[model samples]
Target chain A: MDERAALDLVGGLVGRAGDDAAVVDGTVVTTDMLHESTDFPAGTTRYTAGWRAVGASLSDVAAMGAEATAAVAVYGAPAFDAADLEAFLSGARDVCERVDAEYVGGDLDGHDEFTVASTALGETDDPVTRAGATADDVVCVTGGLGRSAAALRAFDAGDVDRANDLFQFTPRVAAGRALAPYATAMMDSSDGLARSLHQLAAASDCTIDVDEAAVPAVDAVADYATDDADAREMTVFFGEDFELVCTLPDDEIATARDACPVELTVVGDVTGDTAAASSDGAVTVGGDALPDRGFTHGD
Target chain B: MDERAALDLVGGLVGRAGDDAAVVDGTVVTTDMLHESTDFPAGTTRYTAGWRAVGASLSDVAAMGAEATAAVAVYGAPAFDAADLEAFLSGARDVCERVDAEYVGGDLDGHDEFTVASTALGETDDPVTRAGATADDVVCVTGGLGRSAAALRAFDAGDVDRANDLFQFTPRVAAGRALAPYATAMMDSSDGLARSLHQLAAASDCTIDVDEAAVPAVDAVADYATDDADAREMTVFFGEDFELVCTLPDDEIATARDACPVELTVVGDVTGDTAAASSDGAVTVGGDALPDRGFTHGD
Candidate 1:
């Protein structure tokens, strides 16, 4: 099956398996992939690469309005050295400490290639799922988007110095917590802004209209995007953004923004339909006419 | 790194990561691998196979002397059909239910080939470790050994019917619980009896002597062995036997056996040396001359 069908089947099984944190009561666990399709370097040994994987996984739990409690990582290594494994573990430990999430036990096995699987567990009074948004809700982002993608481009072009800071981007944990009480729907934008917006809209059974001009883009991407079209495309379709995209009541958005003080952007509004289109009329978030350029398994 | 070094490093990391069931402070947890190396089909599957991948993992936690609490499964699937994925999940779910373990959230990704990684958590009052055996401790087993290995051989030889029941051997949870209060040092023997005895001796810093007559073998295996010598070889070297090899004070061994009447065997005694030799002057258990012949990764 394709990604959509596979996801549907998995979602059904997961639902039956138990509710969120169903396996262990009083805990909510979430998982996300930092894969070659989205994250770069193709292996586990790049500088701060392991941290990115742990951070991306933790970000998923944080987006659900939970404080990360523990993490279980399964790494696939093919002909990897002891030093490389130590580096990966060290980086993961650092991230775990930073988030106050303990590094729980996990497994290591050999494979034909290398991949990192990180699962983060957290605790919360009530998790903020993706299906709580309502019509007339204001959509907001916790931090800037398109920077990680821009960093990838910079790294690929040997501009590592310019992308160094962006490469180690931190997940917006504080912002997620601050908005959790106010936001009705929450999810991390690992699969890019447009696709994530479409996901949030579909999950909440609401339409979202993005004010394209209001969405943030990295300055480096603007320099590379020779025209506005390229810049818009990069900002919309580029993956590994790791920004918190939330929908809240219009009144609560202002209060939430004031309390969090991150780069909260009111880039859209939730409507009553299942559509996610751009207000500028130039870009469409989930239009059939647009290409399916988001990250996919085996892509 | 080689398997020994890898195990050492991983053991150290796990030690530092936290103790068993440390995630839930009040609970105790244990873990084991039902690795593809020993428990899988001779041929590859579109997806990974065997309930043991899930069963053995949960059994470790169960033998920890704990109840199956939660589990996180990491699956590596080849580029294959969705039906295979569903089948793998179904098998894993079946084991989870059998052990009363809930299927917690985990990671799933595509790989160059298929593999399965399962981590199970259990709850106990005081956790059991491999280093708790004392000198003059009597060793015992939960069930018969050499059956799984014999089953594998039979299956390989195209006698599936002969091995079917043996292949689906259930973990001795009731027996383990009955024996836990008395077991000084304990571990499930996934490796061969000889290797597991060696491991227990190394961990407890003691010698273990096994009586050849005490070691159990299948009737078919005895018939196939022609004599005691062949049966002894198969019993010593054969792997994937998930029997609990445990040690208890000699006086307490009878109590343990009486608590669970399951043909408890007086396989050996724990001594203050680093050697483990069998009785009947046949094979030494932890002799330095023997080459390690159990299942190994990347073999």
Candidate 2:
């Protein structure tokens, strides 16, 4: 079974599985598991790995428009190293502090490979969901895309410093909290812009018409890509930017932009027309279908 | 670094460690990581693995004297099998149902080895910690010991059915909730009675005198052991029974016994005398020092 099908099976048993985080009585909780082979690159430092791993779960909380309170990590490796463990904890603590949250310890065990499972806890009385988008709502994204793609390129080129720096993107918790009151629907763009757009449209039963020119591509994309088309492709499909992709009323866009701490780029608008909708939900950019592909586990 | 030393380092960074569960306001949260090589035997089924792994986290919540609300797990393995995934989810759901908690959902990833990370969330107005044991308090335990030891013995002896059955021991959530009002200091004996006794004594700054004859050993211990001495050794030193070990006021022991659903066995008492206390904290059984040995990770 693939990750999605396995997730569906888990959903069948648990009944509450599709949301980014599970909320119970105003408390939001989410968990993310990452393996060294799949998540970290060849030159990735233990500190970078720790930051990226915990940041993934915190991004889930951000998707729910929740106030991140604390996080705990479970680290498993074949053996324990004193300096490496300290570096990992230092990174985890720094990331939590960056988001105004606490890193409140975790469990450790020995395994064959370096693996991390991080859980983040948050709070929100009015949490956002992917299924709340409506026709005529404006879709927007935070910061720039293709940051992780640029990082991977740098790693492949043996520029470890540039790769590590790019790997340390800030999670959009503050922006999510600021936009929560104005967003009609919201989710994090961890799955890349294309896949995230498809998911939001499908969940809301709408079509998203995105202007390819309006998507914000990071400056690094130009340095890494061969052409403008390649840059757009990389920005739109390569994930791990840790940016928020959300929908808001056209009238509330200016207010949300004012309230948000990060740059808000207007990328698209939602529509109720089924003419453009497909099984994977309609996500059209520059009058063409956007492929439903992004960062997925066990691919 | 060993697991304990690593945990202390984490505690130094987080400033809120050493407790079974971290309490924030009225919310209780805990996490556990287990590896196949360290946690599961050759004949252990995926279903039993799921139950035991999630039960470990729930047992932590129970030790905090909290009401378990929900749990999430991150499952990572070398490959995904449909039947195995379904069985694992079924076991997770069944265990949550047994404790009246929700098995909400989890994340999945492919790793080189089968590993599981589980987190349990709970609610409590007053959580019992391991630092409240006072002199003259009676030390009591719930359920029988050596259950996991006997299960391991059965697994080694080719009794897979008996081993699986024994691995499905219930988490002591209800009994902990019942004993919360009376328990001055409480914890789950996941590290065996010896280590747990030593830990509680150190945390509370006291000494514990245990009656070796009063320790309750399960019937399976005798069935698997060669003689009474071996049975007693297994029961006292082999851990993973998921039973509650608590210190209660001498005057409240009778009422606590009446309130708890499980049979309460009074096997020891707390004392203020430093003559018997050592660096690992004093735990004397029949006038002899109890060795601080139990199940530990990466041992």
Candidate 3:
């Protein structure tokens, strides 16, 4: 079994769990672990490592439509450096401040490789899960995509500064909060846009139709990519954008957009034709099939 | 620097963070990561690995006098196996059920080494921290110790079953809740009694004088050990016994003891002689000093 298949097996055993974080007694809890080899490339700063690790988990809280409260981190490194630890912590604190959450505390250990495990907690009376979308819901995404993907290419090309800028992403905490009450379903586009749609659709037992023209590419993505792959396709296949993807009624979109601190774009529509995308296919982009393509861990 | 020194550097960055989990707005959050190589002995089962990973964090919740609500785990393995993953998840779910908490959800990734990162959440209106003990308080520990210490000896001696049995520990959730209101300070003895005492003293700025006869040794511990050391001293220096240690008033000890579901032993007295323990010495045992000598990661 691949990592995804193994995860699916484990998920089946865990009761009442959804993609992203889990909600228990009005609190949303989530965890993410970043290893130096898999999570950080060369030139990735310790500060960025701290920020990215915490931000990844916090994004799950946003996906749940909850107000983030606090976060704790467990750090494991072979050798401890006073300055490196400080930078990493400062990064986490700054990111927590951005979302008005507390970097409360965590544990530290020694390991053969540097590892960071972060857990974030948030509170919400109503949590928006991936299964809540309806056939008539309109699909909308906060901010744009392909920045992280394009940054990876830039990093490969030795443009460390450009890639670093793209690596630093802002979690859509405010945007998720603004859309939660109206959104029929929601999740973060941490995986590629195509995979995210497939997951949400599978969870809701519905089909999502993507309007190829409607997908907005981040401005810097096109200029930064090393290849000439269409920016929209790049956005669809590349992951780690950290944007909020939500499905709501068409009329509610405006209210959500007005409430959000960032730009909102309508990317697709929720459809009743569930079989259209599941028949030996992944996602529907216009009439073409878009296989679930993105980063696969341990591949 | 070693793990402790490195951890000290990181601890300085976090504000008001205690040794165990941190409490925020009545919610207790803690994270722990277990790398297979460092954490698991050769004969450890996947189920035991899962249980130990989640149980360690839950023990932190118990130390804070909180009722655990939920837990999430992030699993990373080089190549996924369905059976292995199931065993791991089953272990986590079973442990959570034991504590009356739900194993909610978490992230999954792939890596070269098997790693389990678990985050536990609990609720407490008043959290018992390590810094709350005053000079007038009495230091006590729940249950007997040195099982894990003895377990380590057994593992080295090829007694896998004995070691695994000892590794699977129950978090003191009920006992912690029972003692929360009365205890002045609290923490888990995951890092050995000596280290825990030193930490509590440093955090609370009070000295603890351990009575030699008061320390209880598990009957199995003596039989399992290969060396000729004092059983109680072995308990003090060896760690990973998931028991609770707290400080309360000398008179309130009985009330706390009456409230506990487990045996609560008065091991020492919290005193005003802070400088005595802090003057490059750790944990006073009779006239001799018990050095913090438990497992040190990356040592």
Write out the backbone clash pairs for model 1.
Answer: none
The weakest ten consecutive residues by lDDT in model 2 chain A span A272-281
Clashing pairs in 2: none
Local lDDT at B273 for model 3: 56
For the predicted complex of model 1, DockQ is 0.33
Clashing pairs in 3: none
Better of 1 and 3 by lDDT: 3
Q: Give TM-scores of the second chain, every candidate.
A: 0.81, 0.97, 0.94
TM-score of chain A of 2: 0.96
Error of 1 at B272 (Å): 2.5
Q: DockQ scores for all the models shown? A: 0.33, 0.73, 0.75
Per-residue alpha-carbon lDDT of candidate 2 for residues B97-191, written as tens digits (9 for 90 to 100): 78888898888887777888999999999999998998899999999999999999999999999999899889999999999999999999998
Across A10-58, the per-residue lDDT of candidate 1 in tens digits comes to 5676553322223256456555444453355532244366677777877
Clashes of each: 0, 0, 0
Recovered native contacts, candidate 2:
0.66
Ordering by DockQ? 3, 2, 1
For model 1 chain A, the run of ten residues with the poorest summed lDDT:
A280-289
Model 3 lDDT per residue over B1-299, tens place? 77788777767778846568888888888888888887888888889888899999999999999999888888888878888888888888889999998888787778777888898989999988888788768889998899777777778889899888888888899889999989988999988888898899888887777886787777668787656565765687777888999999998888889999999999988867566555546467765666767766667
Return the candidate ranking by lDDT, descending: 2, 3, 1
| Cα-lDDT of candidate 2 | 0.88
Provide i-RMS per model in Å: 3.8, 1.2, 1.4
lDDT scores for all predictions?
Answer: 0.65, 0.88, 0.83
